[model samples]
Target: MRPMMSPPLLSPSPCSLLRFLRLCHAPRRRNPTAAPPTPYTFRRRPLLLLPVAMSSSASITAPNSVVADPSALARKVAAIRAAGPSKLQVIADFDGTLTRYWYDGARGQSSHGLLRQGNEEYDAKREALYEHYHPIEICPDIPLPEKAKLMEEWWEKTHGLLIEGGLTYEAIKKSVSDAAIAFRDGVVELFEYLEERDIPVLVFSAGLADIIEEVFRQKLHRSFKNIKVVSNRMVFNEEGRLVAFKGKTIHVLNKNEHALDMAAPVHDSLGDPNGSIDDYSLVKKRTNVLLLGDHIGDLGMSDGLNYENRIAVGFLNANIEKSLKDYSKAFDIVYLNDAPMRGVVELVSELCP
Candidate 1:
C-alpha cells in the first residue's frame, strides 16, 4: 500500500467534473440522442488519512497510457481512498476486461465466442452473426440507441441459434474445457485481494453466464464469496439441454447493474447472504465504485447505482490510435496494449488500505 497525503482541505463535491473532462479532452459535436457521460462523484465528508508506505505508488503508473489529466485522476483516487473500501464496490465487464484480449499470438475468446453447440451448421451461422454485428459493435459512427438495438438483435439471434443447435449443459462444459479463453494476467491476484477484503465484485457482462461460471470452476478452481456474475443465462431442461435464455438480452450497450434482476448468479454455491446476485442489498450500500471495462460504454456499468465516487479504468485492446482520445476522455485511467491487472490490484490496495 502507498502512503496517503494528509487529507486535503475539504471542499464541496464538484458535480461538473465529468462535463469538464469530456469537453476539454477533445472537441466533438455531442449527439442529441446520446446520454451524457458521468464522472467520479466526489462526496463531501470528514475523512481520516492512513499513513502507509509509498513504495507501491510507482506501480500504479502504467507504461502504456493514462488519462490526460493526472490531477483529476489523483482527485478521484484520493476521494475513493478517503471513503475507504467499506463504501466501495467493483463492477467489471467480463470479456476483454477480466479476460485478456490477446493470448499467445492470437485473439482470445470471449465467453460468447467459446461456445460450441455440437452442430457444424449452427456454429457457422453463429460465426456469421459475429462477423456482421461485431463490426457494428465497435463502429463509432452509429448512434447509441441504434447500436443498442443492433446488439439486442445480435444476442437474440445468437441465442436462437444455440437453442436450434441442441446446446446441452454437457456441451457448455465441454466447450469451456476446449476453449482458448484465458484471464488477463494479474486478474487472479486482484480477485483474491477483493475476496480477502470481502469487497463485493460484480462481474457484469454481455456474454453467457453459464460460460463465465464454467471459467470460474475450471480455470480458477473455486468461487469467491465476494464475487457475483450477471449475464445472459441459459435455461436447461431436465435432460440437461439448453432450451432458451431466461430474460431480456443483455447486449454491450445495456450491460449494466440495471440487468441484475433479469438474471441470477450462476455460482450460488456460497449459499449465504452474499451468494446470490438477486440479493444486492449489501452492494446497494457501497456507493463508491471501481469500474473496469474495455469499451467506452463500459463506464455505464455503474449507471444503476447512486454512486458517490467512481474510478473507471478502461483497457484499450485494439484500434488504439483511433479510439485512444475518446477512451481517455471517458475513462479516468486507460491502459493500452492489453496491460495486466497488477496496476488495478495496486490501485485497490491504495483505496482499501
Candidate 2:
C-alpha cells in the first residue's frame, strides 16, 4: 500500500495468510442440515470417477473355420478386405486341399492315386513305392531336402510303372469315374464364388494334370475359365496310350520353381504376329493371395508371386495331434479333422462383398 496501514486486528502468520486467500477463492460448501441443491447446481464428477457401463456378457467371433491366432487372422482379414476381390488370387492344392481327404469313410484317391486302383500291376508297384517312400514323406523329424530327394525317386518310379501299365486316356477317365474321389465339402461353392468374382484359381498339384483336368471337367461340369491346372501332364501316343510325361517332374518340393512359368500365358493364335492379346495381364495385377494346402510343402505355392498379403490355410486331415503345432507354425490358419471350406467361403464373402 502507498501509505503505512494501521496495525491489523491480528498479525497473521504466512500459513494463516495462505488459508485466508484459499477461503476467499474456494467454492462454498452446502449447509449440512440444508436440502440438496437442484441438478443445475450440483457439482460435476471428474471423468475418471464416472461410472462406465460394462457389458456383462461379451462374445468374440472368429472369421475363418480354424485359425492358429485369432488376432492375427483378424488383421489379415482386414487387410484383404481393404484390397477387395479384384486384387485377390487363390492358389490351392488339388489333392487334399480341394478334394476330401476321405470320401464315404474311406481314404480318397488323388489324381495319381486314382490309377493305383483297378489295376493289379499298378497297385503292386504303388504299394512298393508306398512302403519305401510314404514313411519318408510323412516323417516330421526328417529334413525337407532329404524328403524331397526320396519323393523325386518315388514319383519317377511311379511314372514309369504307370507307363508300363499301359494307362490309356480312356483308362484314366474310367479310373476317375470309378474311384471314390470327390471334391471336399464347400469346394464347389468355393469355385463358384471365385468364378463369380473373376478371381483366378491356380490349381498347383504334383499329381497328374490330365487327370486333374478330367476330374474338373467330369465332376464340376467343366473347368472354370478363371482356373488353370498346373501339374505333371501325361504325354500320350498317337494311338492315345500313355507314352511318357511331358516335362520335368513336379514333386512336392519343386512346385514353386514352376509357378512363374505356369502363370505365363501361352498364345493360342501364333497367327497374330502383333501379339496384342493381354488377357492375363489382369492376373498379374492381383497381388494378394489365398493359399490352401494339406502338406507343409504346399506353402511354396505363393513363393514366386509379388503378393502384398498371403493367407495360408492348412487342412490337417491326418496325424493331427503330432502335426498341429507344425501346421500352425507353417500356416496362418489350420483346419483340423477335415474341416469343410464353409468358413473359407464365409471369409471370401466378407472380402469380396
Candidate 3:
C-alpha cells in the first residue's frame, strides 16, 4: 500500500498538477524586448544546479528543418523565427516525451521499469509499487495534496528497491544499452535543429542519467552538442561501483525547487528581478518556447521560462479516449499515440505570421 503524506514534501495533486502543468507549459513570460540590455551568457549545467542553462544556435544534420504546411505553425514559427532561437529554450521530459512511450507497438521499458526488471528480486517489488502508485499517478480525480503524499511514498519505495538491486555503474550502462529506448518521431530532427542553432535543450526527467544518455546515443546519428539531461544521475566510485544518486529525490511533482536551484544563478546573473536567469535567459525579449511532454505533471517541464509566446504539444500515448479532453485542455495541441515532435513537425510548418 502507498504510504500517506508527511511534512516536507513537494508535488501537487493530480488535478492541481494538471492545472498548473497546463498553465506552466505554455511559457508564462512574454515581452522579450522590454528588458534592459544585458550580456548573453551560457554555462555548462552542474548536476545540482537547475534551469541555469540557455542559448541560441542551430546546426542541422539533415535539411529537414522546416516542416510541410505553412498555415498551422505559421504564427508560432514566425515567433520562433523572429525570436531566432536567442530568447527561446527547449525543456523536455525524457521517458515519454522524447523517447517512445512504448515499443514494438507496446509499452516500452523505462529507467525505473528496467531497474525493476533487472533481476528476480525486483520483479515482485516492482509489481507492488506499480499496483500501489501507478493508479494514483494517472487518477486526475484525486487532490494534489493527497497525490503528493502518495508520490513521496512511491518514490521512496522505488529508490529503496533500486538501491537494493545491487547495481553498479557498469550495470546501469548495460541495462540502458539493452533497453534500447527509441526517440519519439521528429525527435531526431528536433534535436538536430536545436544543436545547429545552439539553442539549449534541457531534459528533465524522472528517469536515470545513464539511460537517458543511452537513449540519446541510440537515437541520434550525431553527438549531442547543445543538450543537457537534468534527470537523476548515479554516483560511481573509482572502481566504477555505483555508490549513490546525486541530489534530492526528483519525483514527478517536485520539479519547481529543482528548477529554481538550477536557474537561480543564471536568473540572478542576468539581473532578473525574480532572482536569476542563468547565462542565457531562457525566456528573454524574444522569449518563445516549444515545449513537449507526456504526463499531466509534465506541463511544468518549463516552469522557469518567462515566455512571450509558447506552443506546447503533448503526446497522449495511452488512455487517450478517457483523458482526451483533459489532455487537450492541458496542452495547446495534443497528439494521440503519435511519436514525439510529429505534431511539433506539423506545428513548426504551420507557424505563420
* Highest TM-score model number: 1
Deviation in Å, model 2, residue 119 alpha carbon: 5.1
Cα lDDT of model 2 by residue, 146-265, tens digit: 889889999999988888888788888888888778776568888889878878887889888878877876776644556667788787999888888877888877676344444322
Error of 3 at 61 (Å): 31
Model 2 spans > 4 angstroms off: 1-65, 116-119, 260-278
Task: List the pairs of residues colliding in candidate 1.
Answer: none
**Residues 129-246 of candidate 3: C-alpha lDDT, one tens digit per residue:** 8888988887878887788778878877776776776666666666666773666656777766566666666777776766566555544634554555666666667886566777
Candidate 1's TM-score: 0.80
Candidate lDDT values, in order: 0.73, 0.66, 0.54
**TM-score for predicted model 2 compared with the true structure:** 0.75
RMSD in Å for model 3: 16.2
lDDT of 1 by residue, 130-206 (tens): 99999999887788889989999999999999998999988888999998888876788898898777788888899
Backbone collision tally, model 2: 0
What are the RMSDs of all candidates, in order? 11.1, 23.2, 16.2
TM-score of each: 0.80, 0.75, 0.68
Model 1 worst lDDT window (10 residues): 45-54
Error of 3 at 168 (Å): 0.6
How are the candidates ranked when ordered by TM-score, highest leading? 1, 2, 3
